[model samples]
Target: MTASDEEMPKLLGDCVHCGFCLPTCPTYVLWGEEMDSPRGRIHLMQQHAEGEPLSLPMVQHFDRCLGCMACVTACPSGVQYDRLIETTRAQVELEHPRTPAERAMREAVFKLFPYPRRLRALRGPLRAYQKSCLDKLIRRTGLLDRLSPTLAAMERLAPPLGRTPRLPERVAARGERRATVGMLTGCVQGEFFPGVNAATARVLAMEGCDVVIPKGQGCCGALSLHSGREEEARAFARRTIVAFEAVDVIVVNSAGCGSAMKEYVRLLADEPTWAGRAEALSVKTRDLAEYVAELGPRAERKPLPVTVAYHDACHLSHAQGIRSQPRALLAGIPELTVREIADPDICCGSAGTYNIFQPEAAAELGDRKAANVRATDAELLVAANPGCSMQIAGALGRQGVDIAVAHTAEVLDASLRGLGRGSLVQRPQ
Candidate 1:
């Protein structure tokens, strides 16, 4: 159903214009304009709802937003910026015509991300292109010369592709345990960073919880929803809820997927049949770091001598409000030194497909983030989100920096199992 002109006003009315969100908003600082900030966007929604024409400039301001949801964390007014922005963008897509190329790209992303088979099929080509020197040749020839800067920035963010790690159907607890959690094998994470899944399983097992990586479960549809494929996202969410129904908890290592899974209630809100079930499923979902941290003393520990820097994934810190849990878990390792990267809350510009879609802007943000990470001089970079790990790892790799980038759980699990240095230094193949 289309959003009515009336509904916009009701949504806008919720924003009290407290201005607590300004400092956390990236676009507001970039443009230094009130209209670009969350409060400003809410005002624009109000105007558009009340029959005011949305000018091209107004729409451009809205498009410039990274949708990192940093404002949502800072809003004392409980503005629900994510809901407002998503609904507004949906309205924009329906009412305002997009260019043919833009529409095609959006359609392509929707078709690619929500389907696991297609994503797996593309991996071979992606790996071949990267390894064949063809990627370098494209850069050297300046074929896509205009996109070089953006591509260069993204290239720096790519992680080395290694063997994909698949978790067992069911890993019984080592001694005795009553808890079992179904792992949400995310689309990109499953294909790209399987080591993370392996580490998550090992860590969960150490905590005496049986880890279940159910087959047939697919992407959480975070990317699809972020890219405006709401129907596809909803379908995937329903499928995921069904697949994990028997498990006590649904564990997600990727912050982006965790954030999306937690919001399954909102995604299926309109569906009477699925709404309650989605909410129930969402309640059981937990980020890997959060879950391990909650398991308390069960997390095993050994000294890890590496100095590690933590980069907060936008979805984890802002979207999920999960800032401290990961850090506390990391600190539990006696040998691990946890250092903080400056501007930790800023987006690394790997907002799902944002790096691919808005490459230029994404490059600037990624570079800024990479620089901040470099300044820390930490031997290991730990992040909870797969996207952040890939983005930051790619950036560091491009600069000839050899510091290992890994998920927080991977690092912590190593410490617990007395495999700290070996697990981290040995590249997963």
Candidate 2:
């Protein structure tokens, strides 16, 4: 469908020319270009609404946006920029045709990133490459980015791979059952960082919950949905709803997946067959930190003296309005100090595949973030999104900072089990 076929939603008018979003937007802070800010994009949407043709330049302006939703959070008018951007992107995907190179790169990303089996196949070779010092040699020589910028960026962002344990279909509650939730072990979370999901299950079970690791679960349609491949995202959403089936709640460890799943109702709005089911799934979905906090401290938390800086994933902080929940959960840990990084509202440029798509900008934003983290002088960094952890870890590595990074769940698991360190995965030596 083209712009002529549908009118732009009235939500676009809510901007009120508010400059409040200017400072909050990542791209605006970096480039200071009017075409890249939220207000500027809304103006372009207005032009399209008024029958101005969608030009390639307009698409570039939209493409430059990180989609971090910082403007939405900063706006007092409560403008729904998130919905506007998604709608515009769906139009872009349908109406615009990219050059062969750009198209192929996007296709490769969608094909590979959303599937677990393909990524699972890559774990062995990637681990060997890192362990054997090949990765170090390549980074030292500067041959990687020259070979293929995409591969080089991906390699740098790749997490430390280990023998991922298989998750059971059902993990029984340890003490007394408080609530039953079907866990969405995300594609990347399942294949690349399975330990986080395993830790999640253990912590959930310890907190008096029957954690069901439903089989046949796949991507929660976050990548597709965020990128405006509406039909594909909808299909993934329905599969998740079908897989979970009547659970008390749907718990997610990944922030991006949880944000997309929570919007299942809106994503499936056009489908009569699955719309109600999508609503049900959306209502029951909760972030791991959210659910864990509600369940309260059921198990023993052992002391581990570590100063941890909590990096807010954009989706979790801006999209989901979750700031204090994870911090509250972390504070429950004995002797664990929570330090706030400078410019907490800014993104580390890992807005889904933004780091992969716009590597240069991602690197700059990443370096800025890593520098702020370094100044914190903390021993550990905690982030909810795997993409953030991957991006931030790579940035810190490049800065020659050796501070370890871990998911919020892994930290909780370490405290609950009385384990001493090594729970949080660190960069390759």
* Candidate of highest TM-score: 2
Model 2: lowest-lDDT 10 consecutive positions: 1-10
lDDT (tens digit, per residue) of candidate 1 on 395-428 = 6655667777888878877887798576786554
Pairs with backbone N, CA or C atoms under 3 Å apart (clashes), candidate 1 = 156-394, 156-395, 157-394, 157-395, 158-394, 303-335, 304-335
Task: Supply the TM-score for candidate 2.
Answer: 0.96
Looking at model 2, the pairs that clash are none
lDDT tens per residue, model 2, 351-420: 8998987888899899999999999998899999999988998999898889898899989999999886
RMSD of each: 2.5, 1.9
Q: Each candidate's TM vs. the true structure?
A: 0.92, 0.96
Against the unseen true structure, what C-alpha lDDT does each candidate score? 0.78, 0.88
